[model samples]
Target: MSAGVESLLALLVSRGGGQYGYEPVSQLAHALQTASLAEAAGEGAPLVAAALLHDLGHLVEGSEVERLARGEDDHHELRALRLLKREFGAAVVEPVRLHVQAKRYLCAREPDYLAALSAASRASLAVQGGAMSADEAAAFIRLPQAEAALRLRRYDDCAKNPLAQSPDAGHFLPHLRQAQAETRTAATRPDSPSAQTGATS
Candidate 1:
C-alpha cells in the first residue's frame, strides 16, 4: 500500500477506541459508519473514499479532538485536505475541505438543519464561524464541490451512532488505493478531462 493509505489505516485502527469528539462513537466507528453510509447510498468510489478519510485531519492533530471541548477549531478539514490531496484527487480532497463549510452552508440555507445537529456539533459550529451570512451562503453554493460536500456533511452528522455496526478498516483499504492511483494517473495525463480543468489533475 502507499504511504498515505498506510497512514490512514494505521490512524483509524490505532484510534479505534477513541471517542469522536463529543459523539458517543469511537473515531474508527464514525469513519467506518460514514463510509458505509456513502456506499449504501450508491456513491462512486471517489465519494466513498472521501467519506472514509474526511476526518483524517483529526488523526493528524492527534489530541485536537480533546481541544474541541475547549472551543478550538483545529481546522481539521483544511489539514486533512492538504494531507490527502497528495494521494487523492479533488473529488476526494475538496469534499473533505468543504465539509465543515458545508455545515455552515446548511445552517444558512436549511432552516431545520441546525436544530438537528448534536450538541457537540452545535458547539463547534460557533467556532467554525456559525451559520454563513446570505452572501457567504450564495458564494459557497457556487463552489464546484459544494453539493458533494453537503452530502458528506449529512453522512457525517448521522455517523455518530454508538450501536451502529461498520465494516473494519481493512474493508475500505482497496478503495483508498484506487483513489490514490486515479489521482496520480490524472495528474500525469495532460490529455485527460480532469487535466483540462486543473481540478484534481
Candidate 2:
C-alpha cells in the first residue's frame, strides 16, 4: 500500500476508536458508517472514498479539536484537504473540504435542515459560521463541487448513530486502493475522465 493509505489505515484502526466530538459513535464507527451509506447509495468510488476519509483531519488535528468545544473553529477541513489533495483528486478532496460549509449552506437555504441537526451539530454550526448569508449561499451553490459536498454533508449528518452497524474499516480498503490508483493514473493522463482528484487543494 502507499504511504498515504498506510498512514490513514493506521490512524483509523488505532486512534479512530476515540469519541467523535459530541457524537455517540467512535470516529472509526462514524467513518465506516458514512462510507457504508455512500456505498449503499450507489455513489461512485471517488465519493465513497471521500466519505471514508472526510474527517481524517480530526485524527491529524488532535489537540486542535479541543478548541472546537471551546467555541473555536479548528479549520480541520483545510488541514485534511492539504493532505488529501496530494493523494486524491478534486472529486474526493473538494467534497471533504466543503462538507462543513455544506452544513452552513443547508442551514441558510432550509430552515428545516437546521432544526433537524443534532444539538452537537447545531453547536458546532455556530462556531462554523452558522447560517450562510443569502449572497454566500448563492455563491456556494455555484461551486463545482457543491452538489457532491452537499451529498457528503447529508451522509455525515446521519453517520453518527451509535446503533447503526457499519462494516469494519478493513472492508473499505479496496475502495481506498481503487481511488488511490485512479488518482495516480489520472495524474499521468490529465485528460482521463476517471481521475478522482488533482495534485493540489
Candidate 3:
C-alpha cells in the first residue's frame, strides 16, 4: 500500500475504537464490507478503495469537525476525495466525489432504489435533499460515469449488515489490499486514460 493508504488503514483501526449505533459491528467492519461489495460488483480498484475509505475523513477529523463541515452543507465525499487526490491522484478522487451523488441519483431514478436503502442512508437522503426531479435525474443519467455510479450504489446498498446476512470483517482485508495495490498501480501508470480524464471520465 502507499504510505497514505497505510496511514489511512492505521487510522481506521484506531478510530474503530468501539462500536457506535445499535449493533456489535465495528466501524472497521462496515468499511470492510463496503470495499468487499464494491470489488465483488466489478468496481475498479480505486473505486473499491474509495468505497472503503469514504468515511475516513470523519474518523480523521472527528465528529465535531464533521458536524462543522456538514453545517456548511459540505459533504464528507469532498474531504475524503481531497485527501485521496493529494496522496493518490485523480483516479481515486473522482469516484469518491461521485458516490454520494450516485446514492441521490439512484434514489431518484430507480423505482426500487429507495426501498433498499439502510436507515442511515434513508435519513441522509432527506438531508441530501432527497430524490431529484425527473429532468434533473434525466440530465444526471447522461453523465458518462453514471452507470458506474449506479453500480457503486448497488454495492453500497448491499454492503449493509442485514440481520441475517452479515459477513465477517476479516474476509475483506485481502480484497482491500488487492484493491489498494491496484489503485496504486493504476494511479502511477503513465499511460492511464484516467490521468488524461482527471479521473472523472
Candidate 4:
C-alpha cells in the first residue's frame, strides 16, 4: 500500500473510540461493521474505507465542546477529512463531509426515516437543525456527492448492533491493513500512461 494510505489507516484503526455511547462497540468496531455492510451492498473499496474511517476525526479532535473550548475546531468530520485529503485525496473526504448533511436531509425529506434512527441520532437531530424547511433540504440535495453521502448514512445506521456487531471488531485490524495496502497500490498506478493513451485497447 502507498505509505500515505497505510499511515492514515493505521491512525484510524488505532485512534477510533468505540461507538458514541456503548463501550462494547467501539468506534473502530462500528467502522468495520459499516465497511462490511457497504461492501456487501456493492460499494467499492474507497467507499467502504470511507465508511470505516468516517468518524475518525472524533478521535483526533475530541468531543465538540472540548475542541471548541480549546479554541480548535469541534467538527470531527472536517478534521478527519482534512487529514485524509492530505493523504488520500478528495475521493475520501467528500463523502465524509456530506454524510452529516445526508442525515439531516433524510430527517427532513423522508417522514419515516426518523423512526429508524437510534436514540442518539434522534436527540441530535433537533440540535443539528433537524427542523430545516423543505427548501433547506432541497439545497442539501443539490450537493454533488449527495447520493453517495446518503449511501454512507445508510451504512452508518446499519453499523449499530450491540451484540452481533461486537464480535466483528476483532477482525478490523487486519482489514484495515489490507485496505491500506490497496490504497498504496492505487496511488502509485501509472496515471500518466492512462491519461496520455486515452482508452487502453
Candidate 5:
C-alpha cells in the first residue's frame, strides 16, 4: 500500500473509534455504515471510498468535540478534501467537499427533511450556515458531483443509528488503493483534463 493509504488507515484505526460528536454511534461505525449504504446504493468504488472517509477531517483536526463545544464549524469537508485530493481523485474529494452543502440543499428542497436530522446534526446545521436559500440550493445542484454529494449526505445522516451494523474498515482497502492509483495515473497524464483542474475537478 502507498504511504498515503497507510497513513489514512492508521488514522482510522487509531482514532475512528471515538464518538461522532453527539451522535449515537462511534466514528468508525458511522464511517462503515455510510460506506455500506453507498455500496448498497450501487455507487462506484470511488464513491464508496468517499463515503468511508468523508468525516476524516474530524479525525484529522482531532477536535470535533472541542470545536462543537465552543460552537464552531470545523469545516471538516474542506479540510478532508484538501488532505485527500493529492492522492484521491475528484470522484472522492468533490463529494466530500459538497456533502455539507448537500445537507443545506436538501433542507431547502425536500419537504420535512430538516426534521429528520439528529439533534446534534440540527445544531451543526446552524453553524454550517443553516438551510440554503432557494437560489443557493438551485446553484448548488449545478455543481459537479452535487448529486453524489446529496446521496452521500443522506447516507451520512442515516448512518447514525446505533442499531446498525457494518463491515470492518479493512473491507475498504481495495477501494482506497483503486482511488489512489487512479489519482496518480491522472496526475501523470500531462495531456489529461485533470492535469489542468487537478484532483478537485
Candidate 6:
C-alpha cells in the first residue's frame, strides 16, 4: 500500500474511535456507514472512498470537542481534502472539499433540508455559513463534482445513526488503493486535456 493509504488507515484505527462531535455514533462508525451507504447507492470506488474519508479532517485536527466548545467551524473538509489530494484522484477529493458547500446549497434550495438536520449539524451550519445565496448556489452548481458532493453530503447526514450496520474500515482497502493508483497515474499526465488543473475542478 502507498504511505498515504497506510497512514490514513492507521489514523482511522487510532483516532477514529472518538465521538463524532455530538453525534450518537463514533467517528469510525460514521465513516464506515457513509461508505456503506455510497456503495449501496451504486457509487463507484472513487466515490465510496470519498465517502469513507470525508470527515478525516476532524480526526487529523483532533479537536472537535474543543472546536465546538468554542463555536468554531473546524473546516475539516479542507484538511481532509488536502491529504486526499496527496494520494487520491480528483474524483475522491473534490467531493470531500465541496460536500460542505453542497450542504449550504441544499439548504438554500430546499427549505425542508434544514429542518431535517440534527441539532449539532444545524448549529454547525450557522458557522459554516448559513444557507447559500442564490448566486452562490448558481456558482456551486457549476462545479463538476457538485452532484457527487451533494450525494456524499446526504450520506454524511444520514451516517450518524448509531444503529446502522457497516463493514469494517479495512473493507475499503480496495477502494483506497484504486483511488491512489488513479492519482499516481494522473500526476504523470500533465499535458492531457482531462488532467486535473491542480485545484478542486
Ranking by lDDT: 6, 5, 1, 2, 4, 3
- TM-score per prediction, in order, is 0.88, 0.89, 0.70, 0.74, 0.89, 0.90
Work out candidate 2's RMSD over C-alphas.
4.1
Query: How much is the lDDT of residue 110 in candidate 1?
Result: 88
The lDDT leader among the candidates is 6
**Whole-model lDDT for model 6 versus the true structure?**
0.86
Best by TM-score: 6
Which digits, one per residue and each the tens of the lDDT, describe model 6 over residues 157-185?
99999998888988999888887776544
Global lDDT scores for all candidate models: 0.84, 0.83, 0.62, 0.66, 0.85, 0.86
- How far out, in Å, is residue 189 in model 6? 10
Model 6 RMSD, rounded to 1 decimal? 3.8
lDDT of 1 by residue, 1-201 (tens): 777678877876886667788789888899999999998998877888999989888877656566776777889888766557657778888899999999999998888999999998998998889999999999999999999999999999999998898888988888888777765554634456665676653
Predicted candidate 3 versus true structure: per-residue lDDT over 1-201, tens digit per residue: 445556667777788555422334556676677777776767766667666776665565545234533633346666665456535544455566667788888888776888877665676676666788888788877876666666666766665563424344444445455655555545544357775666632
- Clash pairs, model 2 backbone: 89-197, 89-198, 90-197, 90-198
lDDT of 2 by residue, 1-201 (tens): 667776776777797878888889888998999999999999988889999999888888654348876779887777777667656777888899999999999999998999999988898888889899999999999999999999999999999998998888888888887887775444533354433454332
Model 4 agreement with the true structure over 101-134: per-residue lDDT tens digits: 7888888778788898887667556555564588
Residues 1-201 of candidate 5: C-alpha lDDT, one tens digit per residue: 777777786787789889998998898899999999999999888888889999998888757778888889999888776667666877888899999999989988886899888899989988899999989988999998999999999999989989987888888888888877765555634346766666343
**lDDT for position 198 in model 4:** 48
Q: Ten consecutive residues with minimal summed lDDT in candidate 1?
A: 183-192
Query: Candidate 5, clashing residue pairs?
Result: none
- State how far residue 4 of model 1 sits from its true place (Å): 2.8
Report the candidate with higher TM-score, 2 versus 3: 2
Instruction: Name model 3 segments beyond 4 Å from true.
Output: 18-24, 62-74, 162-201
